[model samples]
Target: MKLKQAVTGMAVLACMSTAAHAQSAGTFFFSTGWFHLAPQSSSDPLTVTSIGGSPTNITEANTGASLSSADTIGFTGGYFITDHIATEFVIGVPPTFDLEGSGSLEQFGKLGQAKQWSPTLLFKYYFNAPTASFRPYLGLGVSRVSFTDAKITNSNFEANVLHGPTSVSTDSSWVPVFNAGFTYAFDQHWFAGVSISYLPLSTTAKLNSTSTTVVGTLNIQSQTKIKLNPIVTYANVGYRF
Candidate 1:
């Protein structure tokens, strides 16, 4: 009977040790991964205004101002505030996307390029016991998406279409992000995970053109609304310390 009790006690001690090592307060984790951004992109009709003429609307289906998908490396870091709660920061190298024309402007090919940098902050709740090899998590977060390096890439469109120097700019905005994922622990310190997030992001793009026409330096303004509801996916290998 004493031998049996001793064996059970040792087993219990081992289980406790594993649980403690898995997740504890003050533990820090870092993850690096590959990410893909697939955007369900849509745009409003381009509204064009000329200094000498009335504003006119160009339909998106006619202009084809759509963006393409992007893939890049992503990173995340987290701090376990408790055994079941953590705060994480998600970031990565900014991804560049090519703006393309589809319907009427399809012949114009690539219209321009826009690069975005979005960093997110999340408060996550992990489920199951800390000793469990697999834990699913849910997170609510905020992401700030800013666009830069937006320029007109098609020389023909600028010279023939605009008849002058054209510049492009995008408006920045903040949005909410929703996340769901699971992490599998290979050991106490190493793990692998996959995450999925959705962000309902929207912005306005402005195109400014200066043309030396018979009417003088004609200042033309064009604006478009772009809706990018992107579903982002990540596969990561992580370590905890």
Candidate 2:
């Protein structure tokens, strides 16, 4: 009787252990990776004119100094509400960009720099599969972008038929965003993904005089509204705990 009771108790404990593992099949994970955002297009106008004089209207076109792609790095923390539903918070440094344009017929070197930081909340839905490997997901989120510590240099332009230089500066604002992507899980603890997002960023810029020839202080204010379509491709390593 003693032997039989001991066997029964061990069998119950084993069954409980199996049930617990099955309930927690999906795990929490943290990821950090490098991101590259290519400005597929910008609808913002690059307005250039004299500070105190009549400003020239430069419309948004395939001309002048515009951004191409910027390098970015960020981190993410997420958890699985279920095997098919999850949420995450992503934080990262803005991609560094350069504007390529001729200053009054002279090509300037990297006219300025704009850096951004954003915290985004996202909801993800995973596809059900026989195996966890090769799991694909889609996501949506909102982001707040802050641009700061912008610096401009080596700018020259043509004004009143006289060769002169100009100074460019700007302030940042918030934008609405949307994104979609797919993640492929290589194992229980590793994954990689790719995504694209649209960001509506608009702001005003203050033009200042940085020319020795151009006299008087100019305060030309211009408004620019841009919708950025960024194709983000990234590969990340994640740890599930």
Best by TM-score: 1
Find the candidate with the highest lDDT and give its number.
Answer: 1
Q: Residue 23 deviation, candidate 1, in Å?
A: 2.0
Model 2 earns a TM-score of 0.68
- Compared with the true structure, all predictions reach lDDT values of 0.85, 0.58
lDDT for model 2: 0.58
* Per-prediction TM-score to the true structure, in the order listed: 0.89, 0.68
Residue by residue across 49-168, what tens digits does model 1's lDDT show? 544465765443465468889999999999989988999999979999888866666788888888988999999999987778899999999999999898888998777765678898
Considering only N, C-alpha and C atoms within 3 Å, which residue pairs clash in candidate 1?
A: none
Q: Which runs in model 2 stand beyond 4 Å of their true positions?
A: 1-26, 43-64, 102-109, 129-131, 157-171, 200-203, 210-227
Error of 1 at 142 (Å): 0.3
The lowest-lDDT stretch of 10 consecutive residues in candidate 1 is: 52-61
